[model samples]
Target: MTAILSVNRAQKKFSGLVAVNDVSFDVREGELLGLIGPNGSGKTTMLNLISGALRPSAGEIRLKDERISGHSAHHIARQGVARTFQLVRILPSMTAEENVMAGAVFARNRLWGADAHGLARKLLARVGLDGRADMPVASMTYIDQKRIELARALASDPRVLLLDEWLAGLNPTELQIGIALIDDLRREGRTIIMVEHVMDAIRTLCDRCVVMNTGTKIAEGDVAKVLSEPEVVRAYLGDDDDA
Candidate 1:
């Protein structure tokens, strides 16, 4: 399959500190590409670059062959790229349905009024929050808030969905449900880049994996193979100490 998104030698610097350094990868159309590494490995930074939340200091990001590196976040969202934050972000003052409607209203195709409301309800149900559409986001549990965020991301009908540790804080049961929901999205042919620490989810969901360390890519290949690489092991576990 052709690449739906490409990060060409992307780099991001904050003052003199390099947050993401010459990281390059491609997310194929309909493939769930895993971006995994230790803390401070620049995974979220990479997502920010792709989502237009941060402009790259060097290199470029392309979506369907269109350069989007310097574009604004809203512009990127309006261009069919939607994302869920590592920490769930929602409109605290908005009802579940209204929050989701915000996505549709600001999206690429832009829905309105009843159309947005209808889509919001459908997405709320899709994320398993059926009758709670009238409730404020603040009243929901952490996992439920996650569901709302995912539903909101989907409301835009995004071509590429960026999931930044969407499964981070779930318990065992919730993890299963979260994995299944993501699997359903994958089966529906959604192109996704997932930044995760959960190895089980990485093995279960990703078609390929990209491993990063200290802001640079260390490995890229099949999940099992990449996980077994010596450098990848060192990046995560720190040099066996005896060796």
Candidate 2:
């Protein structure tokens, strides 16, 4: 697989407190990479940094040999990197299809605007929202909101997709649908980095896992191996000695 994005020795600090320390990793083309850590372990912070919402104190972030560090969020977004927030980004008054059309902005160059709406319909359909396209977000549940968010992200036609806590709050049925949509995205060859706590979802979707602790990387490898590591277990299970 080809390396599409790389973070080398990345560091981010605020008020002399380090949030992400010397993190290094590479996302290969068409690979689903999982980021896992205990609460307050810098998972979301790292995601924010890479997505250009925050600036790193130091380090190099490359998108296929092009330096992307310090670039604005919108600039990074235009470079084929799209992220869906933990909270839904849809507007309550807008129809689900309209929400997705918001994402299809600037995509007309790809299809002359003739097929873009068709593409949005297909994305909505894929996420099981075909019948709910005209429904207002205020009338939808959390699960539907998330599914629409995923469709919006895909409208970018991205090379790398970063999903923040995509499975955080949902019922069993909702979880199943969420997982299925993510699986479908992967099957379509989108390289995804998912920071999620649902171990079952991670195991079912990610090709490998990167575990972090106290703002630093502790272990990384195939899902089962990393999940079984002593340090990995300690990070998630807690170290009682210090407490």
Can you write out model 1's per-residue Cα lDDT over 107-217, one digit (the tens) per residue? 999999899999999999998899999999999999999999999999999999999999999999999999999999999999999999999999999999999999999
Global Cα lDDT for candidate 2: 0.87
Q: What would the per-residue lDDT of candidate 2 be over residues 1-243, giving only the tens digit for each residue?
A: 899999888999999899999999999999999999999999999899888999889998999978888999888888888888878788778888877777778442243254667777888998888888888878888888888888888888888899999988988988887898799889988899999999999999999889988889998889999999989988888677867
RMSD of each: 1.1, 1.7
Best by TM-score: 1
RMSD of 2: 1.7
Deviation (Å) of 182 in candidate 2: 1.2
Error of 1 at 88 (Å): 1.1
For candidate 2, list the clashing residue pairs, or say none: none
* Residue 59 shift from truth in candidate 2, angstroms: 0.3
The reply for model 1, stretches above 4 Å from the true place, is none
